[model samples]
Target: MIKKLLLTFSFLAVSMLLAQKNNDQQTVDEASEKLRLAMISGDKTVLESLILPELTYGHSGGHIDDAKEFVEKLVSKKSNFLTIENTNQSIQIVDKTAIVRNHLFAQTHDFGKEQGEVSLDILYVWQKTKNGWKLLARQAVKAEKKK
Candidate 1:
């Protein structure tokens, strides 16, 4: 009888852990979607809310931008995103941090430049704060074309 109870408790504990992981994954997914929309919309308020004060945004061309510069570029339409699509996304949660990887394809219309399309593989690090998940860092590399 004791053996059966121990097995039952172990099973319940494992089930509960899986449930919580799923919930966290869903929440992170929603946050990612919100970020995608905000980027395309260029809404400064939403962008500010999602990004941390110490963000490190790395571009494919090897330029890096701090949180303020990143926000300012987007808000000023200097890095305007007309459309963004994220694919093959996977998020791994470790403690309070989430590591996300995905393929990003976007149509951009920067100020004083012609519209262009970009394809890149992006890595994003997000931290769970009291206010929710905020972006801590991001890096992008140009995506390789399939042969």
Candidate 2:
């Protein structure tokens, strides 16, 4: 009887852990989708909504920008892209923060008429804040480019 109870408790504990992990995964997914849409649409407001006030972005342009600068550039019509693809995304949660790693494929228009596909390795750090999951920092590096 005691053995059976122990086994049941263990099973329940494992089940609960799995459920929490899945829930956390979903949260990250939603945030990522929001980010992708914001980038493609050049909607800095949406992107800023997900970002923490302390946000920092290390762009592929060999420069870094703070939350304000990042939003301004995105909304200024200076950078235009037709598509943004998030591929092979993985998230790791540690306490109140999560790190999402993924690759992005992008195709841009005009702006020197640059048309090609580029692969970028990206890292997004999110913090669980009073509001909700907020993007703390995002850093991306160019892995490859095909012209």
Candidate 3:
């Protein structure tokens, strides 16, 4: 009887842990989608809420921006995103941090320039804070062309 009780408790504990991980994954995915929409919308409030104060945003062109600069560019339409599509996304959570990778295809018009399309592979780092998950850092590289 005691052995059965111990086995049941162990199983329950493992199940609970798995459930928590799944919940975290779903939350992170939602946060990521919100960020994508915010980028396209250029909503200052939403962008500010999703980004940490000390963000490090890297572009495929090798440029980098801090949180303030990033937000300013979008708000000012200096980096206007007409449309953003994310594909093949994967998220991994390690403790309080989550790592996300995705392929980004976007139509953009920057600094009132002509529209262009970009294909990039992006890496985003998010931290789980008191205000839920906020973007910590991001880096992007040009996607390799398929033959």
Report clashes for each candidate as comma-separated counts: 0, 0, 0
Order by lDDT, highest first: 3, 1, 2
Query: What is the alpha-carbon lDDT of model 2 when measured against the actual structure?
Result: 0.82
All candidates' lDDT scores?
A: 0.93, 0.82, 0.93
| Candidate closer to the true structure by lDDT (higher is better), 2 or 3 | 3
Judged by lDDT against the true structure, how good is candidate 3?
0.93
Q: How do the residues 94-133 of candidate 2 rate in per-residue lDDT, one tens digit apiece?
A: 8779899998988866355557566799999998877768
Score residue 114 of candidate 3 by CA lDDT: 97
- TM for every model, in the order presented, reads 0.93, 0.83, 0.94
lDDT of 3 by residue, 49-147 (tens): 999999999999999999999999998989999999899999999999999999999999998699988899999999999999999999999996422
Candidate 1 stretches greater than 4 Å from native: 145-147
In the predicted model 2, the residue pairs found to clash are none
The RMSD of every model to the true structure, in order and in angstroms, is: 1.7, 2.5, 1.5
Model 3, 52: alpha-carbon shift in Å? 0.9
